[model samples]
Target: MTTNRLWRTLSGFNLSTRKWTQVNPRKARSQVPSNLLSLTSWNIDAFSPRAIARAKLILDHVLHESKPPDIIFLQEVTTAVRASLLQDAGVRGGYLVTDAEDQTAFENVPFATMTLLSRARFAFGSDSTEASEDDEVDGEGDLMIGRVSRMSLPSKYGRDALCVDLIKPAATGTSFRLINVHLDSLGHTLHYRAQQLEILANVLRESGCGGGIIAGDFNAISPEDEGLIDMNQLQDAWTALHGETGVEGATWGVGAKRRDGLGPGRLDKVAILGSKAEAMDVLRPGSIEVPRPGQESIFLPWSDHCGLSCSFTF
Candidate 1:
């Protein structure tokens, strides 16, 4: 894509293109191995009982899919709940991490185990501090504007998001990190989300990996959405690979219901750090509209929110 086109598509370019684009360019060839690594991130809204059952149904669909995600990130879930579910599923998930935000105390719970599950060798990333104040969660009357209203950055509501760095086992090892985030939703504050993104960026910078994938319910709309991330520094895997328009694409819902339709709403995101991975691309909706076998509809109602997954070769 031309520089102008790329800029228009991404819509956010705080830093000059000359300075940022130089960090990394799209690789001539894909870094992905013959065997692709797939991952899924969903906000299960596990706090709700009905949603929990839906999550189970979604998990069942995922496990049945032909090529299940090698790594998965599930949000809004309690650690205890995940433990019991994993036991029931008979699948052992490693590198499990949960959030310790104070809001977790409301139900007498300390933290929600927003889990990062994987079948590969997983390394955990450090957690960001949780938000302590009440106004932080309840955005200061700036919903439509989507910009930060105050000076304080809302700590992740007692539920620190989780990130997992995964490495391929080989004589010449290749590693990448996966950051799963669930930003504040009650308040559509882009500035707050931007701060969270900054934290995640720092995590990737510290990972020492050449590049990594950041995925989650970002809670912000796409660049197309007036109030959203600029995303110029990051490369969107799905949009890059999926060509620009499709329905089964968007990961969010519209109107009264949380997941009301099939329309595309790119609220959920999977962004690849330009400095790290090469030839990043979307894998699940690879080639055709239908999901790869063993992974079909694995995302359905798993959480109130939809799932975001991607694969990048290092």
Candidate 2:
């Protein structure tokens, strides 16, 4: 698609090209087993050192979950924060990490990037071993680095989607693609988000993968918004497991001292396409508190937006 067409679409203009395009519907390629896979997605709010430090604490805590996530998708991660996460002992042992930033955009816009971390190997038919306490003795595990790619979006802030493919063996012996995205944060209008979603949908369509997981800070208050409707192929994990309701899931602005003139809303999400996503009993929609470094009595949210974790069977 041309840049002008993309801009026009984002501006609420419908393209006749989309109607004429005879794209075949993607079919299910593999049936994933009942093996429960934990996935986590979060917006770290890494605009400052304090926020990055808090994100680190949250990452450390998340790594220690009873059934730790096998894969993680993160957004709003700056270069410094990514470096810190790479060096953190919590992630050093078994995680393979990759990140992508919008190089096409200016450098002063905070340059937030999307990141993916996986414990699975990157080769198909490889032995997939879960990391254990004993595995830490070696300082690293057998997790192979996955293939990573970036798809730039039509945004002034250099927004982009980072995708990683984990090709390790599973009960069903199939590879899985994990996409991490951060849509236009400044654009609240439905048309603006629709344009970004169109770009993302095009990427997914071209990927040709049967099914995979997509998670990020969408910055959309409601999933039913028109912009998000274009992504009908993907199923929202929250709504798939729990039927839609009026009550807001509210992942954003939950535990902040300042609301930033924004009330509680569900912006962060984990959605699945061509796979079944089941919410584990341990999955709870809420905020995690992070205490100040020197002041134990003072506690704040790990991020302006709370971390979201869910378990998927596929």
Candidate 3:
């Protein structure tokens, strides 16, 4: 119920917080580049009318998989929905979560971004077991610790970037960071969105991590978005893997129950910020039909937006 590591930046004060939380420190840290690195970015609509069913299916789709992606980014996750995430057994044993323990209110906002790193790929720190919920994972779940940081972005909405840094313990090895972000929404806030990107860029620069990802609901509606992407030194992973196809990459229209007149747009995206991705593809983890006895089966895309999955060389 109480926020573990809440950062509030309402007065332009950067009260960013950084912590190394341990999930599975020793057991999961041995592998290297030979292992495939992958991630999935999604914005599960927290305010959906069918929030409960949607959340259940979303968990089943991502965590129940025999082999889930290495990294996952979820946005617009409300406190109620987050309860489902923290309680899942698979999540407890298989992944390290940002904003899990001691995660204070989302600056009193209803929703915020959360990051999940597979225990198979990343290791965590030794201390902070109290921060973890209930019990720890099997076989020395607290062997190594991983780094997680959050910076309050400049937004009228209580938005912030949840960044998980995969820094190499060794001095010679390379490191990368993954950030889950939801920029300012709507078309009228282009300048505001641009400011958000700038803050993210600075975070990357100051981090000194080699390179990594920035993915989530970018609200990419205006043409200025393209310029903003380049301006922030972020490359469109999908476009690089697959050519730029405007509406083809759209992620948030059909599922939009509200239809805010924004129409169809690729509001959700996976981007590379000073990093390289091997492959990129759209994932419909939320796609499943809800069964009914006599009535026609209802289609649920899980949320208003589709998911983007990618593999990174680093």
lDDT of 2 by residue, 1-314 (tens): 64221100001111343221111111111122224567778787765347667767678767877656767777777666765765565565445445321133225657555454433322211111221222212112222223455666677566767765544322123445667778777435556567766665555455434456777888876445523733555677777676554334667755444535656667777767656776722223223454566876454456767677788764
lDDT of 1 at 78: 58
TM-score of each candidate? 0.58, 0.68, 0.79
The residue ranges of model 1 lying beyond 4 angstroms of the native Cα positions read: 1-35, 93-113, 116-156, 168-175, 221-232, 246-248, 254-264, 274-302
Candidate 1's displacement at residue 228, Å, is 6.3
Predictions ranked by TM-score, top down? 3, 2, 1
TM-score of candidate 3 on Cα atoms, chains taken together: 0.79
Best by TM-score: 3
What are the per-residue Cα lDDT tens digits for candidate 1 across 184-206? 55344556676666666655565
- lDDT at 50, model 1: 50
Evaluate all candidate structures by whole-model CA lDDT and list the values in order: 0.44, 0.54, 0.66
What is model 3's C-alpha RMSD?
7.9
**Cα lDDT for residue 187, candidate 1:** 43
Model 3: per-residue lDDT, tens digit, 60-154?
Answer: 78776666887888888888777777767677667767666555746588788877767666543333321222223333322223356677666
Q: Relative to the unseen true structure, what is the C-alpha lDDT of residue 86 in candidate 1, on a scale of 0 to 100?
A: 42
